[model samples]
Target: MALSSLDEVRERIGKAARLAGRRPDAVTLIAVSKTQPAPRILGLVSAGQRVFGENRVQEAEEKWPAIRERHPDIGLHLVGRLQSNKAEEAVRLFDAIHSVDRESLVTALARAMAKSGRRPDCFLQVNVGDEPQKGGCAVPDLPRLLEQARAADLPVAGLMCLPPADTEPAPFFALLAKLARRHDVAGLSMGMSADYESAVMIGATHVRVGTALFGQRGTEDG
Candidate 1:
């Protein structure tokens, strides 16, 4: 069942990419594995899924080290809020971070990278929806944050966003893409199971998908 679901999601990604006149390889599918067990993730790995996203550093630390030992080529992305104190652990565990939204986190990540000699690609999360509760740099503050990230010498790969729920997401996705263009950043990590196709049409380079590939949380064991 997991293999078939993965295959179906890959097919959807390919179709979405083609519709955008882009190569399927241009958009990476990051299978989010937060709250999932190692065996479940390995099941996806067995089915040829190479990239995964996790929400929490502690959960990833508990599961990924063993998984990486067996499949060293897999890419792990941190797709959730990151605390300054965990910057070092996050840098050590993730190949890319998709929720970098503030100057302090950037500074911490920079110091961690310097000490650990490991630099992970980073995306500035923008609160395109203007929600007070979301974990992203306010849209108005994006430019300043970007400048701070560059000054810290972090590898700023792109911008990421989570559009407001129960509303149209295209505008938000377009906004993020526009910001990335203005900043000359190439990657746009937007989209998920519900609206990835729309995101791809608007030029998303990386899509964080979980339920579409892994089923609802706690519903299946893989």
Candidate 2:
């Protein structure tokens, strides 16, 4: 079931990318593995899924170190609200971070990177829908945030966004793509289980998916 699900998702991504005139390889599917057990994660690993995303640094620490020791090719990503204090641990654990939204985190990550010499790929999360409760940089503050991140010598790989729930997501995905191009950033990490196909049509470089790959939460726990 896991292998078939992965294939289906990959095929959908390929079709979407081709429809947009982009190569299928251009879009990376990041399995959202937070709350999933090691056996389930290993199941995907056995099926050739190498990249995974976690919502918290500590959760990732508890599981990934052991998993990675066995499958060293696996890439872990932090796709959650990152606290400033966890910067050092995040830097050491994640290969990529998708929720860099503030100046303080930028500063902390900068210091941690310099101290550890591990430069993880970073995506500046933008609140494309302007949701007050979301965790992303405001559209208006993006330029300044990008400046600060660049000045800090952070990798600054791209932009990420979680559009308002239950609304059309294409517009938000397009907006993020425009912002990335305007900022001269190449990667766009926008998309999830539901709207990833739409996001691919708008040029998303990374799509984070959970439910489509794994079964519903708590349904198949180890």
Candidate 3:
């Protein structure tokens, strides 16, 4: 029998889990669906994979809503940097937001969820690479930010980070796991196609994978 797409993903996920002494179900495989047409997503849903991640607010606004109507069971997660202006829409659409860093974004998401009568699960995006160009809370500032989120009754489920390019990711993932444990955070949503196994070893509960599973997302995108 041939390996279907979901089977391939399961195999990859299982391998990564086994290497880390974890069960396959311990990791939530966030199938990144950025720029793929809706039909492709629908096909994946038909195969019984339930969770999906998207990178852009506008793109989700355009694509997820219609698909949402048809497959209401599909869970949506915002896996990209989010602006304050887009926070409300993000809370409306996504089951979780994986990239929240600033106090302003937290305020926006909290307010939006307050009015909508629903709270979207969220994670603080940490800039583990300390790259000024990327979007994440600096490690030093994370405690204060996590405090603020809790003070505001925002159910911050965990922390998320992007490792800097050209480096091994173990240290960053280890630190993230430690932080998650210290705060009793529920998740560590790090790792992607290349470094996910390291993330699993370091206690990642959710891994956002795109290219290695979906065969590269969007033309000319890294």
Give the candidate number with the greatest lDDT.
2
Give lDDT per model, in order. 0.91, 0.93, 0.85
In candidate 2, what residue range of length 10 has the lowest lDDT sum?
A: 213-222
Full-model lDDT, candidate 1: 0.91
The sequence of per-residue lDDT tens digits that candidate 1 reaches over residues 75-182 is 999999999999999999999999999999999999999999999999999999999988999989999999999999999999999999879999999999998888
* TM-score (C-alpha, index-matched) for candidate 2: 0.96
Report how far off residue 49 is in candidate 3 (Å).
1.4
TM-score of 1: 0.96
Best-first order by lDDT: 2, 1, 3
> Ten consecutive residues with minimal summed lDDT in candidate 3?
213-222
- Candidate 3, 23-123: lDDT as tens digits: 97999989888988988888888888889999999999999889889889889999998999988889889999999899998889889989897788889
Q: Give one clash count per candidate, in the order shown.
A: 0, 0, 0
- The best candidate by TM-score is 2
TM-score result, candidate 3: 0.94
Candidate 3 wrongly placed segments (more than 4 Å): 218-222
TM-score of each: 0.96, 0.96, 0.94
